[model samples]
Target: MKLLKEMIHPELATRTGRILRRHAARGIVLREQDQILLLFTERYNDFSLPGGGIGEDEDMELALVRELEEETGARDIQVKAHWGYIEEYRPYWKPDYDLMHMTSHFFVCDIAPELAEVRMESYEVANGMRPVWVSIKAALDHNLQVMSRQEETMGLSIQRETFILEKISREIIF
Candidate 1:
């Protein structure tokens, strides 16, 4: 896929540079034992997959690994599939940019099955954030307030989820 600069709105190109200092980024959804791992975010008090902004000139997969480790204290990630992309929108509350949005590359991943040690970033999740393992069925609901907040930041409206479902559906089934 083309970089966001090549494909996005012209306005995004002009203002994004000055407004947002951070560059492209990626994230991951790690699954184990029919459940998915998620982190509660401090910024919005939302439940989201572990992720973060990509640094300058960083590769997408490398960014994914970095984010997963920083947010979830996870290591040795084994990616399963590319779950597609999300055009993340930074609402007015965000202070890091002149632009009001970002784009993210997302993937589905897996780690060790049993409960292994986790190292949560205390600063990132002092109270509003914590690692939670939820069943796939429960996680798919995406109805709670935290999830809604997560949806907003992650650009996870209905259409995005639908696309992700379509991408992963075949692999999930026989």
Candidate 2:
């Protein structure tokens, strides 16, 4: 896939002495007419695409399929196109690491007519995360609103999600 964007967090611009943990994640764009598949996290009061971390050595396609299933209960997923990837450098906040470099790959996909049950992780559950079919504009607007407030409830991935939502709205959904 091609590189879409590289976002270096403003806070990390002057920081140093940090260990790097490179993470690879995948997300999908599953659209039905005017609606798109998204994960709404009540805790963050924001929306994001349905996907998550890719395990070590996992195939990108496999990870996309697995993440769609795990996060949105999406079935019959067909990754139609490689949308591209976004790279982010942000605070890691772990004992051994102070920065994280993440590469998030995105795809344009098609899924079954009906969704099954979401198998969200424990943290997702605690955050009140649920699958929702919403317009790309809605997701983008809502995330931009949350980011403007810069609240404590905001999640780490919100910026990336908002950026992707904007890109999708412009490049695909519009």
Candidate 3:
């Protein structure tokens, strides 16, 4: 996996803490028409790519497929390309978790029209995660809005997604 970008929270270096690393899988679902599939979460008032963490001993491609299906009801997806990966570091994102490091692997995928119902996780449902198809410009604009806010108040996950969206807009979307 190539490193597309590295993001470190402003305060991360200021704090003394133990760093923990986690791996996540994310996808940029682009239909033939060029619309992007994103997950809108009302809880955080943000849009994110339709994928999640890689399970232990799971293949990266398979993990992406499973996450897309679970989050967006996507089926028969064909991964077109690997968009590389990104790393993000945030200190004090959680009380129990002092320093958090995450590496996200991204893919460019195409989805089949015949889709099943979305099967979101309980927490996702509670957070109002819903699949939405929008133009790449719209997704980039929305993420920019989220990124423009104060980092102290913004959700860490949202901040990370904002970075990914911006990168996708620049590298993948025309």
Candidate 4:
């Protein structure tokens, strides 16, 4: 997998601690007209790509399809291309899990109009994850605002998504 981007928070780079490794699969769902499918988390007040952590020994493509359907009720997904991957290093993210090293695989996908009812996980419902479609530019702008905020209340996942969206906006949108 190509390294699309690597981000180490200023604080994390200076911290001396053990880091946990995690891998996730993410997707970029693009409609023919440039609309992007996104997951909006009301709890976090942020938007992210429709995908999640790859299960133990799970195939990356299968995990991406499963996550997209689970989160967005999407169907007839055709992964057009591999959108590369990103890595993030975060410290002080959690008390028990002091450090986190996450690598995310992203895919460019197309979904059919007919979709099954969304089957969200318990935690997803609890966190207010909902599917929404917006223009690529709008998504990028929203994420840019989130990234520019002084208070870092957004999750690292959202931050990573923001970076990915910026790249997509440059390469795909504009």
For this target, which candidate reaches the highest TM-score against the unseen true structure? 2
Q: For candidate 3, write residues 54-87 as lDDT tens digits.
A: 9779998999999999999998988888879888
| TM, every model | 0.60, 0.92, 0.87, 0.89
In the range 1-174, model 4's lDDT, one tens digit per residue, is 689988887667553467678889888887666688999887777888999899889999999999999999999988888879988887755677678888899998989976679999999999999999888778777777776784356765667888888788788876
By TM-score rank, best first, the candidates go: 2, 4, 3, 1
Question: Which 10 residues in a row give candidate 2 its minimum summed lDDT?
Answer: 21-30
Per-residue lDDT of candidate 2, residues 23-69 (tens digit): 45455655567688888999989998887777788887898898899
Q: lDDT scores for all predictions?
A: 0.53, 0.82, 0.80, 0.83
* Candidate 2 C-alpha RMSD relative to the actual structure: 1.7
Question: lDDT score, residue 68, model 1?
Answer: 72
**Residue 15 CA displacement from its true place in model 4, Å:** 7.2
**Cα lDDT tens digits for candidate 1, 1-174:** 432222233324444343553444444454545655766444543445566677777877788776777656676677666655555433233555555455656666866554445555666645556667765445445535444455445433333333343333344522
Off by over 4 Å in 2: 14-18
Task: Flag regions of model 1 displaced more than 4 Å.
Answer: 1-18, 21-33, 42-45, 94-98, 114-122, 140-142, 145-174
**Candidate 3: which stretches are off by over 4 Å?**
14-16, 32-34, 92-96, 149-153
> Which 10-residue window in model 1 sums to the lowest lDDT?
2-11
The numbered model that scores best in lDDT is 4
